[model samples]
Target chain A: EDKVVQSPLSLVVHEGDTVTLNCSYEVTNFRSLLWYKQEKKAPTFLFMLTSSGIEKKSGRLSSILDKKELSSILNITATQTGDSAIYLCAHQETSGSRLTFGEGTQLTVNP
Target chain B: AAGVIQSPRHLIKEKRETATLKCYPIPRHDTVYWYQQGPGQDPQFLISFYEKMQSDKGSIPDRFSAQQFSDYHSELNMSSLELGDSALYFCASSRSGNIQYFGAGTRLSVL
Candidate 1:
């Protein structure tokens, strides 16, 4: 059974702190891993990592995939109150685009 | 900068009632995927269409049906709804089958 697990289900941090969220998956024929940020109603795409040893970054957010370990980590630097949201990680198999998602990490950045 | 579009942001229905949800993919996107997210649960894959054809399916209930039209828009029809069917239904579009962009989800409440 393919499954994705995220640790530290909920976290609270003061502004300007750095936080790391972890996700590990076990799937057959894994193709890619994706990250999303869900706020009030919708989830917005964040990053998609298909290779190991390479980090994908957007401003203060970055993520890296460790294919050998079947895991990934998302790092948020200089967190702000506006960054508070649920972070989701998903795995997509090579056979199809169907996604298996992880229970998200709820990060509340306090000012 | 176009994004996937969903209609009827909120709907309230009673048990045994039927509801229809619509999704319009981003222009030129060839694949569309549907997901159901229960309260505090990870999004679950329901179904997907590629180029107006049923390409994949997931844990969707038998009471639910979906289709993609020539214009690449899709609809999910659910019948005999139960309390368990209440969830946030999200639509996502991807041009290359890997990275998916999601739309604002439709929230369904069953009483």
Candidate 2:
């Protein structure tokens, strides 16, 4: 079975702190890895990484994939209370469009 | 830009009843995917369609059936509903081989 594991299931950080969320996967025919932020209702798309080493970034949020280690990390700099939410990591295999997701990391950015 | 749309934001049903969830993909998107997320759990892939055809499936119960229409809309029909089936069902859409965008999701509660 394909599995995705995320570390530090929950975290509490104050404003201006930098946090890193980790995800490791064991999947067959891996194609891509995606990140999402879930607030209250649905998950919003964050980033999609296919190649290793190259980091994808958006403002204070960034992510990098390490295929050699079978892991990925999402970094958030200068965190704010608005960043408090569940961060999800998902894997997409080459054989299908379906996504396999990790249990997610619940991040609480304190003021 | 238009995003994926789902109907009946919330639903309540009794055991053994049936429910239908609908999804309208973003205009011009060619693929749609379905996922189920239980309380405090990550989203699990259920099924997917491409160009109005079933393209992939994963972990979907036998009592659940889904199909994409000619207009690119999809519907998930679940029968013999149980309390365990109560969860947030999300519909996602994307251009083939692109990042998937998710809908607001339909929360189903079975009593």
True contacts kept of 1: 0.77
Question: Model 1, B14-110: lDDT tens per residue?
Answer: 9999999999999999999999999999999999999999999999999999999989999999999999999999999998776888999999999
Tens digits of lDDT, candidate 2, B1-111: 888999889999999999999999999999999999999999999999999999998899999999999999999999999999999999999886588899999999999
lDDT for every model?
0.93, 0.94
Local accuracy of candidate 2 as per-residue lDDT tens digits, A32-102? 99999999988999999886578999999999999899999999999999999999999988634788899
* lDDT value, residue A42 of candidate 2: 82
Identify the runs in model 2 with alpha carbons over 4 angstroms from their true place. Answer: none
- Top-DockQ structure, candidate number: 1
User: How does candidate 1 score on lDDT?
Assistant: 0.93
Query: For candidate 1, what is the DockQ-based docking class?
Result: medium
> What TM-score, to 2 decimals, does candidate 2 have?
0.97
Q: Model 2 in CAPRI terms: which quality? A: medium
